[model samples]
Target: MSGNEISEVAKGFTYLEGPRWHDGRLWFVDFYTCTVNAVNDDGSIEEIAVVDQQPSGLGWLPDGRMLIVSMKDRKILRRETDGSLVEHADISAHCSGHANDMVVAENGQAYVGEFGFDLMGGADHEFANVILVNTDGTSQVVASGLSFPNGMVITPGGKTLIINELFGNKITAFDIEADGTLGNKRDFANFGEIGDEPNVAKRIEAATIVPDGLALDAEGAVWIANTVNQKATRIVEGGKVLEEVNTAPDGIFAVALGGEDGKTLFLCAAPDWDEGARSKAREGRMLATTVDVPHAGRP
Candidate 1:
């Protein structure tokens, strides 16, 4: 799809990330604002949950309840019918880094990631990793030593799990076994620049370095929010660049396919880091775009 074919759906959100399509609307996390929002097709927004802890990933349970990741508290919260959030699991035990984004399977297994080292200032930074947490709260480290595990998706067939290592500029794939374990890890895509720069750290620091969100199209292609480039890139399973959708002022963290036909792409975007925070406090709107493909996997 050409860049012009995509247009903004809304605006003014603080660190918008983790877009998920559910029950006729687009649900996402406003990380800096500490709330989960639902955006309708008519462009109206609703604050569905107020999470004081930084919220990141969003998913649903087998019975259709909502599961949210509380990044600051390092816990998984389940939204109950009475409109209350309950602690489902304390993942702090297994998470080496703050919980970023996650994907839940049809069986209700959640795969969560962490920074492995302090990104926004923690301590004793270590290797980044992904952890598998069961519905009952049991957990285990699935993959380790990643640069920054951000967005993640499990294939519809349930055979593989794809994870985005933001700072590493690479998408990694792991074989998912029947028992919910991951293996055969390999790089799915390496988005490094063609020419090497002497000051890599300076270059990365200036760039968004990939941030926190991704989605799969109906055709099984991955739609990655390249925060550093301020564009959403569509890539096939083998890592072929199919298209790129650029955003205004360009600092988007997450995206998902929604709308009546699942062709509308909703973005949780911000102009930049500092400006994004201010906008979120003043106005909670987030941008959206129209894409050509339907959402992949379960909606």
Candidate 2:
């Protein structure tokens, strides 16, 4: 099976990321605008929340509350049923730089990742660990040695977790233990070469393949946003690039599988990733298309 033609669903956003499909709407955050929004099928927008420190990843707690990542401040915030926000957890001292992406399991355990270094500031590369936040709002390190872990997803059965390593050029997997902890860290998919240069800019430029955000299918394959390659590639467990969709003129940053049949693949993209440039313009867009497999994992 294969996807149909791609089309633009929404446009003129500021660096969209952490895309989630819920309740017949496409929800995502604009990095530069510092706001979360939901888009209707007709392209209308409904503003969700405004994060002063900038919002990155998003998840849903078991009780229906929304868990949002406050990037700059290193905090996880929960959105109540009444449209109010509350502190979920604080991970200020755990991450080296800003928190980036996260995934919540069936048990309400949120696995979060960070930049691991000053990526926008052009600082040296640093490996960061994944933090697990329990339902009670406490947090702890569950896995480590990840090279800029960006996006994450949990299998539908809730037994496995897979994540993207932005600079490592690979997708790593961890077995989810019964206690909601992660174990058996290993490469789920490995690309040819990683970004081994000294600085962030050079490293991003040198990478053969850069895995950013991902979407898992019913058949267990993952669709990856290959940042450096300017395309979205579908890969199997052993790192075989099965399909590639060029998102040129705009680099695909994140993805989500949804729609009536769950074949709709939402692409969050922009032409430039530089903070200064992207923040000053509304060039980002939310694109939608169909895929072979239906979505089979948690957001």
Candidate 3:
């Protein structure tokens, strides 16, 4: 509950990511296992949906239906009331690589990002686009020229959107326009000094602040999951580190603030989630810790 003290809540998964707290439960996606799952307070877990190509982000439409990011095929799938999965939007043609994470708005619109290159094959870096998928199943490239945009969130007032660029080593901010377009792009926080590393994979490996996922707190600060160093950092908009927590054996991919009082910080973590390694083992875990500030903003 204080000073990096954390306890295990759930375990046995093949790489967990895109965690969220919705409907009084914690929801997440197991990338290698290809399933969307939920865990309740009673230590019971339920499979909510299955994604053949794998799933990442989790959110809900204004109508209460669920929206899932189908990573491989670059599609967003929506679950209906009767538990049927339907294609909401196709972003395969728009993205340079596999889609990763998303943030759904209260109006049912979503902003999604992709890898921007063949990462596993060790391809070089290529800027990716953040696609805006409308509620009616139409899509458009809202923001472009990003270095692997990963986790994202809309501010509590819905006026700003913050996105974590994994390889870029910074969190980018955008002004949310009325028409669902992103503008006024700027660096919200600089986790560390990023240099020109010709090798994309090596850049990520060398960077100390390789942020993956993010969670906004009521104090207007963001908690970042630094995948490279296996640490979680709480930083303000101008990049001041307020607090940090370390996960030694396993690395954290994503985080969510949830619980009865919204004080629990749930972390999605696993032991080295490279494609070859994670596919062969199920060592993912959901860890939780208490914090002083409650959650704020969207999932």
Candidate 4:
């Protein structure tokens, strides 16, 4: 499998995000359309659920229920067997901004992150927390003071959780405790230095990279969607860039690995996240390519 020879699997969406392969289909959310859908192998799509507040991430609990992230409402939603959406966990009281991506563990624990500030409103950058939601829907702030913590994945062994610190230009790892709490925060990969600027605007502008969504491979390397660089990068431990796929013009905001053998790399791309342009053109597409390694660990 190589980064070249890209293929378009789906189109006509207003910003696609939170790609996950489950039940032999590609599941994702259309941000502006407010729908969670699954694309089958034959190019047909099925509407699974809808999020009125906007959706960004998707995962599943151990009991086979779907979990969705309601972005603006800062809550995790569970889709019951009756096709109803209910609040699984409300984390708004502990978050400064919108709830974003998430990863569900083997034991049904979910680790979700937030934007940490008014990103679209041009407000100052502030650190946010990662909320851990138990199987029963109880939630707690397991890790905090993070710079825009975005996509996350739990290791196969269920001992570590890797998070993409979007504005921090790095991937951070945390020790996942037996009780579902995160501790011992450390850098897993550092792409570059984040500038120290009093002005929040300048600080963000100085960032060399912004890692958004990520997917872990069987070899322990993570394929990251670089928001600022407009590329999908494969990075292992120690900050090494093993490979990169250019998305140019359109930014690759999310990535997922899955297919019959779990080697297909799915990408979510749009010209930009501007609501005005995305809603008008609906140019978001789900592009894919095969990779050398198969997907591993939790989604």
Across 1-299, the per-residue lDDT of candidate 3 in tens digits comes to 12568998889988899999888888999888899999977898899899999999878999999999998899999999999999999989898899999999889899999998988877888888999999999999999988889989899989999999889888999999998999999988975656656587777776657888889999889888878677777889988888878887678889888897888988888877589898888898999988889999998
Using TM-score as the measure, which candidate wins?
Answer: 3
Ranking by lDDT: 3, 4, 2, 1
lDDT of 2 by residue, 1-299 (tens): 23447798888888999998877778999998999999876779989999989999999987888999999999999999999988999987788899889998877889999888898887888888899998988888888888899889999889999999888868899999998888899889876555445566666666667888889999999988777577788889997878878877678889889887898988888886789999999899988887878998888
RMSD of 3: 1.4
What lDDT would candidate 3 get against the real structure? 0.88
> Which regions of candidate 2 are displaced past 4 Å?
1-4, 193-197
Clashing pairs in 2: none
Model 1, which residues run further than 4 Å from truth? 122-126, 192-211, 274-285
Q: Which portions of model 4 miss their true places by more than 4 Å?
A: 1-3, 195-201
- Sliding window of 10 residues with minimal summed lDDT for model 2: 192-201
Candidate 4: residue 177 lDDT (0-100)? 86
Residue 205 of model 4: what lDDT? 77
lDDT tens digits by residue: candidate 4, 102-170? 998988889999888888777777888899989888888999878889889888999999999888878
- Residue 280 of model 1 has an lDDT of 44
Comparison by TM-score, 3 against 4, better one: 3
Tens-place lDDT digits, model 1, residues 1-299 = 54556555555666677888888877887766788888766778889998888888999998888999999778889999888999988889777667878899889999998866565552443457788989897888888877678889887888889888776657888999888989999877766632232233453564434635778788888888777577777888666888877875666678787777988777666665453344446443456677778887743
Model 1: how far is 229 from its true place, Å?
A: 0.7
